[model samples]
Target chain A: MIVARIIDSIWATRKAEELNGFKFVLGEELTSEGNGKRRIVAVDIVGAGIGDRVIITTGSSGRKMLGDENIPVDAVVVGIVDDDCNFK
Target chain B: MIVARIIDSIWATRKAEELNGFKFVLGEELTSEGNGKRRIVAVDIVGAGIGDRVIITTGSSGRKMLGDENIPVDAVVVGIVDDDCNFK
Candidate 1:
């Protein structure tokens, strides 16, 4: 899992049938090196909001979080980070 | 999925119970710009060998490739690259 912050939400009315009812959010990775920023469109199942720190799982593992293997999702928000966790 | 090359193998005897019997291979991403090399430890399921180009899925989607959601895996080799596809 990678740490990221929800930047915004995506609204796509026309998409694959398997991706219906899933909320998509754009997230920017929070890397230690502070290198080039990488963004990912992740499915939100944890009710995360914009600006919230989150843990995202990518690839097939992300799709599995949605309980579907054939879903065209590559990233998904798995957990919301709290102050107790050290992101440093 | 991201394109990568199998660089080496990892052997860990003591790991999570759900991660037993899985072969972990080190992979380096094959990016277009040739930026800093990104390495990932991915589970091998498609019989990819060292030096072979393969496709990797990260996060839970990667875990789903193993047919188990509870598996403590972050990456998985899903396919072997051939000459037909343009990785450029």
Candidate 2:
């Protein structure tokens, strides 16, 4: 899992059929220093909003999180962070 | 999926039991410009060697490639690149 911040929502008119009805969000990875690193698009499973610190699960775990292995998604927002002592 | 070059092999005396007998390699992501970027440690499933440009699969796909869902591995070398017109 990686810590990230939801930066924005994304919409695509044309995409894989398996990806339909899934909410996508742009997330920036957060370092322990609170710096943002690589940006990724992930399925928003936890209803995270922009500015929300989130926990992301990547790869097949995304499918596992949704209980479906055919979603063609590689990343997913699994949790919203309430507080973290490691980073502000 | 991502493109990377295997830079070095790794050995660990202690690791997760599920990871035993797996070959680990340090891989550096390759840009279209052929420059190296982020580095990652991945299980080498394709017998890739140091200096080999390889295709890597992350997350549960690594487990899928190995035909096991409980390997606890995140990244894997899925293929070795032979010729690429995109990068030199």
Candidate 3:
């Protein structure tokens, strides 16, 4: 898990049906800038914040997170942070 | 900090303006199915799999993961797993 914040959101029409009832929010990853690698921005909608550590989902499970097997979502807020998540 | 699998997807219509354009994939939380907490399901992208250890973004950063801070996102896949993440 990483510490991050919700900055904004994105909007797109002409999309797939699997992503019909989901909301997408924008967020910034707060990891130490790696070897010249650029920071990342994500899209979510689980009511996170600007200084909270949140858990995210990706890939196939990201697909199973929903249940329809076709929505086109890649990342989702499976759980929220309520305590410390020291990965060290 | 958890392992999961993508099961399916969901679609919605007439949602918040913040969530305009984003893909939603389905995934299931894979944590030993503890205390029968109704195994959780999530929506994500980042091209994960049914048996992958992934890193996700949530909360405010979940929002900032994106650029626009008004699109309405909460969780996102900022990075993928390439090694072991022993959080203990």
Query: Which one is best on DockQ?
Result: 1
True contacts kept of 3: 0.00
Can you tell me the CAPRI class of model 3?
incorrect
List, residue by residue over B6-81, the lDDT tens digit for candidate 1: 8776554433445568776767778888665565567899999888999998765667567777554577799999
For model 2, the docking class works out as incorrect
Between candidates 2 and 3, the TM-score winner: 2
After superposing all C-alphas onto the true structure, candidate 3 shows an RMSD in angstroms of: 14.8
Q: Which tens-of-lDDT digit does each residue in B43-72 have in candidate 3?
A: 355666545555555554655556755434
DockQ of 2: 0.08
List, residue by residue over A1-88, the lDDT tens digit for candidate 3: 2234455656779667667767676545433332222233434555565555444444443444355556666666544444443321
Global fold similarity of model 2 (TM-score):
0.50
Could you give candidate 2's per-residue lDDT for residues A26-86 as a string of tens digits? 6777886654356656778778988999998887756676766644457778899885645
Across all models, the iRMS values in order are 8.6, 9.4, 13.8
lDDT, ranked from best to worst: 1, 2, 3
What's the CA error at residue B69 for candidate 3, in Å? 33
Q: After superposition, how far is residue B9 of candidate 3 from its true place, in Å?
A: 30
Best-performing candidate as measured by lDDT: 1
**TM of chain B, each:** 0.89, 0.86, 0.60
- Comparing 2 with 3 on DockQ, the higher-scoring candidate is 2
